[model samples]
Target: MGSPLVSRGFQEFGSALQERRLRLLLAGRSGTGKSATGNSILQRKHFLSRLAATAVTRACATGSCRWASGDVEVLDTPDLFSPEVAQADPGFEERGRCYLLSAPGPHAVLLVTQLGRFTAQDLRAWRGVKALFGAGIAARTIVVFTRREDLAGGSLQQYVRDTDNRALRELVAECGGRCCAFDNRAADGEREAQVRELMGLVEELVRDQGGAPYTNDVYRLAQTLGGLSREERLRRVAERLAAHRELWPLAGFPSWAWPPCWALCCCCAFSAGTCPRR
Candidate 1:
């Protein structure tokens, strides 16, 4: 609703976010245009995208484009979060390698969806993202809607503000009200414009994150610190972070405040009516 953060110089942002290459991860259900969105963001057709009954991206693919004295890397991933692909990465040969390819973790995770086609599966996709990346991942996540033409040039912010979809609105709120649209079919100029818009949002997210990218350590904490309640997990994560503070000390994060930036993820578990009270 205010001025876009695009006009600001990276030198004025929090700490040295400008010094590190910003990494992003593309995620969503099949046919939601994750790969196509990645190509559009990178301004190149590096990932395969097509309509089919089955999945097109079997594993994660990586791409990047330089932006204002730094590079922005993107990982277009498969639907590894789905129950069907739960075991697809047993040996890190498939989607599991995404963890390696994105080594330190992404600065932002784009949970891509199609405009005017929200479904239960869409909400579930957010849950899957939190599960794999740790609930704290929600702190740095962004909801991306493809097929912006469906809006007929209407306002995206207004649409979300007026939508009757409570769960969708909540998911967006959980991500700190960060979302963007993409018209993958736009012309070269408009396509670049859309990418620039997304970069602005990503930069804003990084700034809000205190100039920290979500790290793999949080994901590791998720796997190793299992079976605990949400509160206990948060406590343990805080305790464990002291041992690995060097990993993201530049972000100036506190122990319980996770993902090396802001607060821990409240989780998408609310969609199932099981979300714990804060």
Candidate 2:
């Protein structure tokens, strides 16, 4: 049998060969780092940001991130809680309703938030997010906790377990227990792991939709590596390779040693029949 990584790579390659675009919506309240995460994912400053509590994103902003697998369009949305924007249009709520229906519908809506102090306002904002997007949207949602380094030695799992934050718990349950953390300032192995987990969840959601998995990991890997300088990407890959070798002595030399190593690994594995076709 071929390696699972190689198989996944091939499946993603085949999907990319089809030239399908995956669209995703990034949603959350103001100050949740939704814009920051989108910028990080797209590896560019596509979304606007401000220090004010109620700065207006105004409308949905779109950006694309290209990878070995395919291109993904990420929509950075305005704060759903913007009263002025909501009040300005008589049909605002209906417009919000039509937003999802107008598109192929997002592959996923990443609900983002910063680490520490899950407030009552946060819960209320989450409820509003669900209301506007629809309750069933949870099936396609992923809770992305940002600023992981600020957690003060607390894991996301631990934070969830310890908190009485009912809204957060419900949000996680809605997303089928899918949660990932990222530290926007750090572009290291830990950040890559979080992105991989997010991609894995996206794959599962796509499978559940009776569609082919996008293998977001391949795309995400390419995006991350693409954002780095050539030397930085090589250095990071070497570091990861060394870590993998230390952890798994039976593992062989990595065949895909270039910048898009993850994508290459998935492609080779899929071609060799190690990855699940479904």
- Alpha-carbon TM-score of each model against the true structure: 0.73, 0.64
| Candidate 1 C-alpha lDDT tens digits along 120-184 | 55655676666566678888888999989878989999878877666678888998899999999
> What is the C-alpha lDDT profile of model 2 across 1-278, one tens digit per residue?
11122237435643843336666778776787878788767665778865665655766678886644566778887765332333433334333322432253577778887665444445555655554544566777788988778676668787766655555676677678878887776665555555656667766676676553222322234345656675555455444333322222121223242223222221234433453422
Superposed model 2: Cα runs more than 4 Å off: 1-19, 81-85, 93-102, 152-154, 188-190, 212-278
- TM-score for model 1? 0.73
Model 1: lDDT of residue 109: 93
Off by over 4 Å in 1: 1-15, 90-95, 216-278
Q: What is the lDDT of residue 167 in candidate 1?
A: 65
| Cα-based RMSD of candidate 2 | 21.4
Pairs with backbone N, CA or C atoms under 3 Å apart (clashes), candidate 2: 6-268, 6-269, 6-270, 7-269, 7-270, 9-266, 9-267, 10-266, 10-267
